[model samples]
Target chain A: MEGMAIRLQGLRKSFGETTAVAGVDLEIRDGEFFSMLGPSGSGKTTVLRMIAGFEAPSGGRIELAGQEVTGLAPFERDVHTVFQDYALFPHMTVEQNVAYGLKVRKVPKAERLVRARKALAEVRLEGFGKRRPSQLSGGQRQRVALARALVGRPRVLLLDEPLGALDLKLREQMQVELKALQREVGITFVFVTHDQEEALTMSDRIAVFHQGRIEQVGTPAEVYERPATPFVASFVGTSNLLEGESAHRIVGTPGTYSIRPEKIRVLKESAEADQPEHATAVGTVAEVVYLGDATRFLVDLDAGGRLTALQQNLETSSEDVAAYRGTRVRLQWHRRHAVAVPVPD
Target chain B: MALITRTAGALHRRPRLRLTLLLTAPLLWLAVLYLGSLSVLFVSAFWTTNSFTSEVVKVWSTDNFHELFTVPVFRQVILRSIGVALAVTALCAVIAFPLAFYTARVAKPKWRPLLVVAILTPLWASYLVKVYAWRLILSEGGLADWMLKPFGLGGPGYGLTAAVLTLTYLWLPYMILPIHTALEQLPANLLDASADLGAKGWRTFRSVVLPMVLPSVAAGSVFTFSLSLGDYITVQIVGGKTQLIGNLVYSNIELNLPMAAALGTVPVVVIVLYLLAMRRTGALSSL
Candidate 1:
């Protein structure tokens, strides 16, 4: 089960003049919740299609379960996909939608019902069998789509932004619910989404895509805390992008350096004793925003532009906006958290 | 905020209600003109016709319906009309389905416009002129005979067969466009979703594509069937003695308006029956 669930090697797709999915390569482990995260037109969906056998690659190969499935038809492959729109057969009831694949495979009546019942119950939708998809809410319909995909017992489940169409509250709930369901079933789920929070929340590992290529691939913490490229850094979360350079690999002004919003510390005149790693910056407070538990301040650097810093509002002194915003307050941070990356030209 | 103010606001809504009803005047006229007249005609079907006077006498009885079955020739005409309508509908659906699917699903951006223009060009030409052209082509020593001479598919051309061909050709665009509309509006992701769920070519069509477009198929076919049943020009011009309800109505209209109205109820009844049958197929209606 630790074998490669999907091994996409240099896959590419082009539509007439536009290259939708340029050369992309990645390997997903079996039973892992892997997410392909990218912006719109970043080829995440195209890669998902190639894995599902819906779109053939212009170049490169895909292997699933140790079998070269690059040229196989969609039915010939061992993959199931839940589309973003749910694509729950609108005309079909939840039970019939879940039973479609079994009927196609000519499964026996008793076995089909038993498997469908089990799959539906796994998604916590046991009593929704007789309801049509239109009668079901968006989240329920999405679960029906999940149940349909899982009922087939495919080797890999391709989810193309399955939570994108739900309300905010429902989407967040379903994300946790879907992650739990994935763990319960132990099926390799290849999820596609542009939502960075979603990928960070649920994925065991994520491949950040840009221009149809893997910009970076790692665990959530690795991708977030140690982004390898400018695109990955900015795509993961908000960062203060500053032009800096690296001399002898030590990182100085000339190339872009990412200072995480939380890494900045609001100081009085001297740095705290514990924050004595390196690369401290002194700036005056340009703007401050109070966000309940934490207050954020933008500090204008003497070298160039403004940098945002997030400070926890632990004391009543932090609430003094007149002392922070538009005031000459010093801010400093450690060097390890400020990683430098070359800007993409 | 008070009850008197609420009552005053409700009283001011009367003119808007009057305007809304006034806007429905044309629709009311159409309903009264079509439905009211058809209902009267259907009631007349229960009355018997006098054998000697050959006039329809208004009496409360089902004698005319019973007498309609007593003669084998009347049943033969009825069957011929039904057979022709059903044949036209089936032929149109078969010919249009693939072409419509290709236009909607697979055609390139530039090619779609060209294909649609080609399909619509035939409709822009005079419908009667098309019938006339077919009438000339189907006659003895006509274009069809000359064209088929090399292929050996000729014996001066078949009669009712030629009429069916002409009617199918005439209504082909009507059948194609609606099916094209339905197919075009069909979500591409649905087919993609079906494919990802282990449905191959035929299975995808059976499970996903066919059920979604069943309404369009029903609507387009009913239009072709009923239109062919009511069309006197194509069948009369191309067919010499193909005895359809259209020709039956045409023969009585000049000398006997009442008999023409009576015969008109045949195709109307057939269309109503077709629509009623279509509604039972579990497909949603957009009409």
Candidate 2:
């Protein structure tokens, strides 16, 4: 936990005509829960594989705990991967699967059994050791996979969409459990996922990727609130992008500007007579959507554009939410909340 | 046409009816033709033969069984047949594992199918032709002798060794195909997971690949063992004076059909017992 656990410089991979990971440079801190988030075919998984030494990078160097491990075999590297499919050996019992790494290291039989049981217990699976992997539930099998990887005590753990196969409720529950487990183990956990919400909830820092390149890397709040590019803003969360004349009229900016829906305020004409001090636009309400905990209003601005504003329910009834439709309301926000992002071609 | 279509639709609606229809032909053939003939063979084994006229007497007697158990030549031939079958199976497995692994896992994707075709190409030649070719290869001053001459050694001439070698070569595809299929069906990520768990290549092969493929290996051995046990032609072509149960059965078939029937039961019994023993080891479940 004292130095960088994983580092990649100029990592590139290509399969015939298509490039998967194109020149990725990254450093993961010791014991940090870092997430690589992207859509499918965005090369996030390839980058994770390169770090785990499963795929030799077409060009680059990978350093694990200050030692260069490029071109090394997966077992030779001080890293482990929790594959998306779990990949539990169907023929092996849970205890044997968990003890596999120990056995490979040539540990004594008694110690291997004891450590495997302890690792299984750490995953909250205590008496299910003798059962085969096919006999376990998907969630239980996932935990077995985690135990199998964790029992090896590698310097870093690389997960490639480890919970992508689980149902929503189980995935959410495992997300919390995985974050807690990483905290307990104090191992650098490099998690790869395409689900933005999953990355947001579990990661200490996240790298958002697009089309084989890292678009932005930051803390969750920073990436969500101040996205560095148009792709990050659109991919991370719901953002209303305003560019060209609209951005100039609103923020006096030439570049594209992104505003989160929740940051804009919908003001009624009879409310306190207060006005926005930074930026304001008057528009007629085009659509009003009533969520249980929040209300959304789509405003058609006088400048011939649409903007979305979200407001918390805040003791308001559904009737009030319905009344906002088709009425002219002022969409207001502070200038600081309007983040400028690079416009895509 | 409408009636036929309606009938087809009705049958499709009932899965059990469709399954019964699908299975009827094979079931009837197996029950009436194959098993019926086998039962006739088994019954013939119990009949007595008149030594004076060589006529078969349909009497229920254990005389044939007694000779099968008590005769020294019968016992020697039975044991030798089993030993040759077992040896051929073991040798085929030892050779097939590496070849199948290379074809299924190590060879490049483009080369895999080519390798499989290469392994199967030998099987396309007629069985008789292959055995005859091996006969030449094992004969004096043949290809095997010429190759071994550099080391100052000669070929193992026509005998049990030659029969074993020829049979192993002939039945190798049977072993390689099933094991290759098993290895191919294995999930690619499983190997990666083992390596990720810090298991080296050899350990992964021992712990994961070997166990998963055991069933397929057992399935392959069934082919090799049973086929080797029943083979008489290969031995006739390659075996000089050595006698197996198959050769004994062949020699007795025309003059003493009952004795040949009894001798034929040896391989059937041995194969059944072998299958049962393999089942005890959980090989059937894997298959």
Candidate 3:
């Protein structure tokens, strides 16, 4: 962990009897964009806060740049966080807000202004320096928060759902900008988000957390394609879980198997079994959902199991989908597409 | 059902009538009672009092104002009153902030409401009893002297200092309540954000907590300042020989009604000016 920006060794935190984060170990390399993806109460934010030195870990040690900082205060650590609500100081202008960290470190006033301006420029908020945070739009306020955290050139930047307040379009746009900014500054970013798409898109690597523990840690594709557990498979993306006899009939295994919705192909029941390298399932289309670019079909298999299949609407019209509402269909997919995972308790 | 629904619909259609009904009572009370009496008081301030008969003369004169400015005793009393009011306000603020912050931010969730109730419990007690209790505490050999005697010190012994201390204790709840509410409404995330941005606890309190709570502090001060400005009872009990503007007004009310009215206008003017200054600092919105 010498070259890592942040390392958590057996990190844990408990609020009385309820443990929030339990024995989590992670090594986030310097300059990499890492994300903790989980549902609420899964301890992702707690982990990020511990790294930023806000929450004292109940057990174990936290090393920032190879220096143990478990008992240190947030300001004592060379890290900063962009909070979920942006937390812009209402009384201060954007420049003052951005210059706060520098001022705390006793940076000269002239240099603080220059560095704040530079940081604001990096976030494309150059003219927003004089404006109060309340005067800015939500997206602009989030950018100022980012600038404030970034101005100090912290070793690791912890962001707890910084873009959670933005609307869909703005959130997507910020995702791209944040990724680019991470690359431009080459600073270690430890982001926390509950939105799976956000984690997949913005993160170089992601740790899927569940019940105060890391279920899986991998790159976006690895976590999505080869999810380590049933929790990861179900949480990271759209996964169709099959188990027991259905698992055996579908993938020749008697245990649980996970398949992606997009990987399953739907064909007319009477169509020739032309693709022999693929496994087959015969089921009636239980439900159909049209989602602009794709159509999702809930198929009830003959083996008493139901699985969902999503097909691109590239060559099919609404009429074609309606015609298949009650019709029988054959679901086909490569044998390699089904992944075996542990049964969740 | 139809009658009730129809009536509701009719009321919904006529928002103006509903608004008028909602506002009429308070508006009338303000116009007829509060403002009406205030206008009468200010009008009487301009009239003259007969020197021999003690009758308020109708002739427009500035004699009271002239005396208020020219008389050394009046000037001294006015400045002393303002000084005492300011000291009380400052002491209340200094005491209230930490107590409010503890109740709002630092204390456990189960204890917060209890702490607030403890702070407010004093308000329910009799004001006279509380003042008399303070007089006993400040008496030459009362609790204040007993507590300080071992430390090689003596109590303030019923002087300006005793008045100030008593007034601060009396008005503390007024200061604590608004500051506590403001601090309660302060988002916990803002403090976390400050800490996350590398600000120490004290620095965060100064730069983040103080500015945001200033408006509430000013609002609380409005209560303490104005109340202290017009209060003659506590001073009479504990002030020894101190003569504030309130004491002057009370002494003059029976002998010279016009002079009392003129002197009464001072606290009102001071409060209004203070509110105006506070409004410039955005305290009105917080209130």
The candidate scoring highest on TM-score is 3
User: Which runs of model 3 end up more than 4 angstroms from their true locations?
Assistant: A342-345, B1-22
Q: Give per-residue lDDT, candidate 2, residue B250.
A: 87
Tens-place lDDT per residue, model 3, A122-190, is 999988899999899999999999999999999999999998889999999999999999999989999
How high is the DockQ of candidate 2?
0.80
What does the lDDT read for residue B217 in candidate 3? 97
Clashing pairs in 2: none
Best by lDDT: 3
Alpha-carbon RMSD to native, per candidate? 4.2, 2.5, 2.2
Report the C-alpha lDDT of model 3 over B141-185, residue by residue, as the tens digit.
Answer: 999999999999999998899999999999999999999999999
lDDT of 2 by residue, A183-234 (tens): 9999999999999999999999999999888988999999999999989998
Q: By summed lDDT, which 10 consecutive residues of candidate 1 chain B come out lowest?
A: B252-261
